[model samples]
Target chain A: MCKKPLIDLHDDKLFITFEGELTLYTIANIEKALAYVKTYSFNALQLDFQDVTFLDTAGALFIYNLEKYFTKKEIAVTLLLEDTTQKDTLNLIKENMKSSHKSVPRKQKSFLEQTGELFYNYYIGLLSFLHFFGKLFTTNLRYITSLKNIRFKEIAFEINESAIRALGIIALTSFLIGLVVAYQSAYQLKIYGANIFIVDMLGISIFRELAPLITAIVIAGRSGSAYAAQIGAMKITQELDAMKTMGFEPFAFLVLPRIIALVITMPILIFVADMMAMLGGLIVANIDLNITMELFMDRFSEVIAAKHFYVGIVKGPFFAFLIAAIGIYRGLKVKDDTQSIGFNTTKSVVESIFAVIVCDAVFSIAFTNLGI
Target chain B: MEFIKVRDVRTVLGDKIVHDGLNLTINEGEIYGLLGPSGCGKTTLLREMVLLQEFTSGSIELLGKRLETISERDAQSLRHQWGVLFQFGALFSSLTLKENVALPLIEYTELSEKMIDEIVRFKINLVGLKTEDANLYPSEISGGMRKKAGLARALAMDPKLLFLDEPTSGLDPISAREFDSLILKLRDMLGLTIVMVSHDLQSIYDTLDKVAIIDNKKIIYEGTLQEVTNVKNDFIESFFGKMK
Candidate 1:
């Protein structure tokens, strides 16, 4: 049940009696009462809380604010209270309110200022990333000299999690991609009476570009984001700090194992993806272009160069390094919040994929220039 | 008025029995403490009272609503009548302390943003947090400040009942005492029927009006701190023995 405050206006004095529950549920009615009182020009205002059966913090706040509202207009405000607890609440709120001043509003930034801030943040971020990269590089280099400190068990576990677990998805994705590419090219090649050229097209594209790129993107999405979330959660829970206090280098213990595992597994995963893609292409070629599997292998041996396979497989480690490095880097960059874990995980995936593509592009250009 | 009455409450989590025939009564305007050694299911009973966890076979009547047979509508309304402060503050890491304090009012009431802002600031200050800390996120504040901010949010709704899970567990002695006083002050100021799960002996001595000591799947003692020593229980002896 809700009760509206009884308002009495006589001459220059306004008296209001609040009744029943004075809580969030009844605040709207109290606000209406305040609105009614505001219409009158009163030099003196008395708020009677004796009839108020229930008064919570919100209600006390309203009473306090109402007193402040009329007092600011140079009116005398007096609060009449019979209930000791209500009086204590009002007094507590009043005392606390004295210490809490209004926070200064943030100044709006102009367009140029906003742009400068954005650029500055990115610049700082780039510097931090480079620092992390260098630190990790030196740590790995130092560990290479003394291999006893390295946790091979962690590395093995990470390989199992990031690589061995990823095998099924990799196989399915590469197979579908290979099938689609061969099917699309087979339609065109068949029209030109060049059904045999399907092997050359699939071999060049899948081996040199499609397989490596797809495998990298998959790992970046799968393992890169996971690395970021795992490390970020650890950082949030102060496990990284615990590791440091225990005299263990986090990069070596956490990041290095992931990077080493990915580097070891990436080429293996890509090689598997390569075989699966060829298998898919073989089936498509057989069904679509009426080419026999033996004939496809014979043409493939003749047209597909070892150099194409080398180009694809060689990019695997680089791509893996980029994915794992960026993942761990972004993870280390995570601030002390759950939101930052999600934020960094997203950034890790996007940045690693971008880095993989850029590295692939650079490799393609360098190989072209070297006449390889 | 009996604000909470837990009767014949039994909890079976998988194969482990947490609570068996646990019964307790918390009255209005009393600061109640659920005391037990670690893993005695004190928090579980608190959670069960708040409807966060379910007891296997029991009746928990909170604010005149039976928990097991409560309708969805009644459950929603009952939730509004109480506020829970989880362990570790549990402030939404994404929102600042001000936004966190303002959340319940914004969701439950039709108060304008201006009024809500005033209430939020008042609640923030009422819990002894600085005005400047209002803009900072939960992660930005210290442990004591986080607990205070959490108290602000819990009191945001001006609930009649408050459930706090370990309000002073992680604080230093000074801050812990400060928290104890804050709890006492809030209980007096707001007339809140507080049910807190705590193992802090000093906190138990300072703030609790009545306590139910849970040990070995049942309440070993339920009375004031002054009368607690009369109970013959190993947990009560070891737990409150240090105080003596």
Candidate 2:
């Protein structure tokens, strides 16, 4: 039942009475009445609880706080609890409040202890990641040996969703990047009458770095977030729980398709990216330097060797594996709240981007050592 | 004084007219039930009262203040004067039960942390939940417990009027009866004026002092439960005659 808890000023004393539940449900009404009472001057305030059918800790705390407030303002507040149960409940809550407050300090961890806890959690996180990697590696090896058991349709759909759908964005961004690079370089190269060298720069940069890095970054943002969010939702809704109970492996059904799809498609997406980038460079070369498409192609083929293209494509599957693994890991980390899905998704994106860059750096070192 | 006065209320949602020329009055300290079949706009009426839903044409008053024509600040201030228990406990999943109850106090009041903690502990307990439940998130608790926690959240502001949207639908029979008695006790003790949307015949009969039933987007019957039962009509016959 909802009734406004009210207060009346009578005989220089304010009398507060609750006509409804004093719980959080009706707290606003009680607060409204208190706000009204606070405006007027009174010698004392009294609370009448004879009509109060229910009295709990919340109601008791309200009275106690009201009492403390009035006392601070040089006004005396009295509580009238005619019901024995109401009085007992109030007293019990008052006692428990003190005890609960006291328990806080005893339970609170020390500064060093809290620091140790932070480190301990990170340690556990690293171990969990290693364990996840081991399980995924073993599962993939097992599934690969029995390749006939894999779901090709699901893999095709994943490729369509994660990789094929991403081609548009990748093409657009890479073309623009190539155009920007060629335009910026043409001006500097033209100053030294070395405009023809722009082809060599575009070819090396786009093939050996830009195409692979841009494609990986784009896919990480697109498909990585989706994988994390999808799995996270499944986790929160307990669909993953249901799958586990039914003896369905989430790794094989969910993770495997996504990974297989990304692995197969990443290189194709990179190859497309390379074509778009070179086309953008070729257009800029023709427009800015008066170089014909034939001349541009001839110079590009001479300047950019096949090894540069090979270096970019070679990094695709590794980048794909890293992105998929990070997304799947973050998704699994999502706990009870929908908030965790958001948090994990963002973390997955950031982590995958970092991992991709780190992988690219390693590739750069290895390729340089081999003189590719 | 008339606590709630609705005049010439008209509402149309999407392609359907939910209510037309609807009028109702709710007096102070009277437990009123809005009863109807599913999709009859029982909950819609409650939402309109709380200003969550807007009507096409109507003048609605709460605590002698016009609801439709109020300043945004005044409207927000007015929200503090009443409580709403949603069909499901819409407790913030990120916040624990205690934090959920304390949210309003923290938002609206300048009470000390100690006071809020005490109140949070007390409200959850009043609803028959233990102190341990305070640390538990909504998902961690049972459906019935979540309902109670929702009620606790609604009560956090100590609203005069409690708006309930089928408070007993998902509970077990015993729990439903317990919830009913809890409402009755709150009514008797605090003199609460309750407006609830309910399909449960037992809840309507047990807890409501007055009732209004809607059918075909109109109030088919408006009276005490006994009076409605006495009125012989096809819908009434089909409605109450079968509940027994």
Which parts of model 2 are misplaced by more than 4 Å?
A1-109, B1-244
lDDT at position B241, candidate 2: 88
How do the candidates score on chain B by TM-score? Answer: 0.98, 0.96
Least accurate 10 contiguous residues by lDDT in model 1 chain A: A239-248
Proportion of native contacts in model 2?
Answer: 0.00
DockQ of 1: 0.02
Indicate the residue-level lDDT of A188 in model 1: 92
When only chain A is evaluated, what TM-score does every model earn?
Answer: 0.91, 0.78
* CAPRI class of candidate 1: incorrect
- Please write out the lDDT profile of model 2 over residues B10-73, one tens digit for every residue: 8999678999877788999999989877888888888888876688888888898887887756
The true-versus-predicted C-alpha distance at residue B169 of model 1, in Å, is 5.6
Candidate 2 lDDT by residue in tens digits, A1-372: 657666677889877777656675666567775686788988987877777777667777877677778889998777777888778877887787667754434577889999998999999999999998998987788677887758787799999999988999999999999999999999898999988898899999999899999999999999999999989987775455423322235787788999989999999999999999988988998999888988888887887889889999999999999999999999999987989999999999999999999999999998899877
